[model samples]
Target: MNYGPLLFLGVFLTLASSWCGLVLIPQLQLWKSGGLEAVKLEKTGEFYPPMRSGLAEHGREVYRANGCIYCHSQQVRPKGFGGDFLRNWGQRRSVGRDYLRDKPVMLGTMRTGPDLTNISLRQPSASWHMLHLYNPQITSPGSIMPPFRFLFETRKIRRMRSPDALDLKPPFAPPPGYEVVPKPEAQLLVDYLLSLRAVTPLPETE
Candidate 1:
């Protein structure tokens, strides 16, 4: 009595069921719930999760290119699931609809840095983001996040300082006659970072 055929059948069923439960069923449920559709905000009557566009959209490419997703996660853990709520990472847990606009959603795998689902709301200043990108330690002392100095250029000031130049003091500052200005990619990356606001309240997650 060979049990090989029975074993193979059992394994196949197990894998198929796992795939259906993990992927297929969730996708069908998301579609049924209209996760792709933008819902109206109850407060302002405006649309929630607006589409990504312009330089900010392009900046997402830069972020992906730089592997920023490796160190950061965009999804906030639900209450009692983790300390995300206690840490003030987000106002509420992230839902499927919050990421409707992302073409390939960047719900990162690791959390080397803090969650960035609501970075724009937490740190709204563009200059601060620029400085932080150039050197994270400037804004966040003792931070392990690496600086993206390659995305900026240090050049001698002509007659006047570029308005976009990062303001630095002492150790992190360029030479006396030089100023560090962000390149197009850096600006675009900052724009994308600034666009990451997931504070909207949804009925499903509530």
Candidate 2:
């Protein structure tokens, strides 16, 4: 009674079903439980609008296409030895509700680049982000971040366009010879990044 093939098929199917039932199914259920909707901040002191910009959506696509998740993460682990807990990065631990609006959570697995959960607070300057995106090596000489020059353009400073003048359509194209900037996408991404602040208040005990 050689049951080698049958046993292998049975084991594979069991593991596959178990993995999907336990992990994938639950995740899908969680996703379906709530769609993107704003929640009031507990602190309210530092409240800003949840990312509702068209650029944020475009930036999300850019984030996915670039595989930024492969290097950086969006989640801040529970406070501990992880770099995120360090004073230099942020002052609070992240919570599940903080990411309630995220459709596909970007809690990446790797840590090639520092966690970007608090980048907006850490380096709020738009110029800094632009320079970094244009040429990572220029800002941090040792940075492993690949340059995204293709996403931007360069030219001398000139007349500024009114905020109301921006087109909110997809495939956001900047005006000619105006140094089509990455910060347009970076700004929205930064906005979303900034929005990653944990709604949970910090514990009093050290």
Best by TM-score: 1
| Candidate 2: Cα lDDT at 195 | 43
lDDT of 1 at 205: 76
Q: Quantify all predictions' global Cα lDDT against the true fold.
A: 0.92, 0.62
lDDT tens readout by residue for model 2, 1-206: 47999999988999999899999987787567532234455676533235546666666777887788999887776667666676455566655555655667788998899888778777776566656776676668888898787666454446774432323122333445344445466656544544444434533212
lDDT for 134 in candidate 2 is 65
**For every model shown, what is its TM-score relative to the native structure?**
0.91, 0.65
Worst 10 residues of 2 by lDDT: 163-172
Which candidate number has the best lDDT?
Answer: 1
lDDT of 2: 0.62
How well does candidate 1 score on lDDT at residue 111?
Answer: 92
lDDT of 1 by residue, 68-89 (tens): 9999999999987889989889
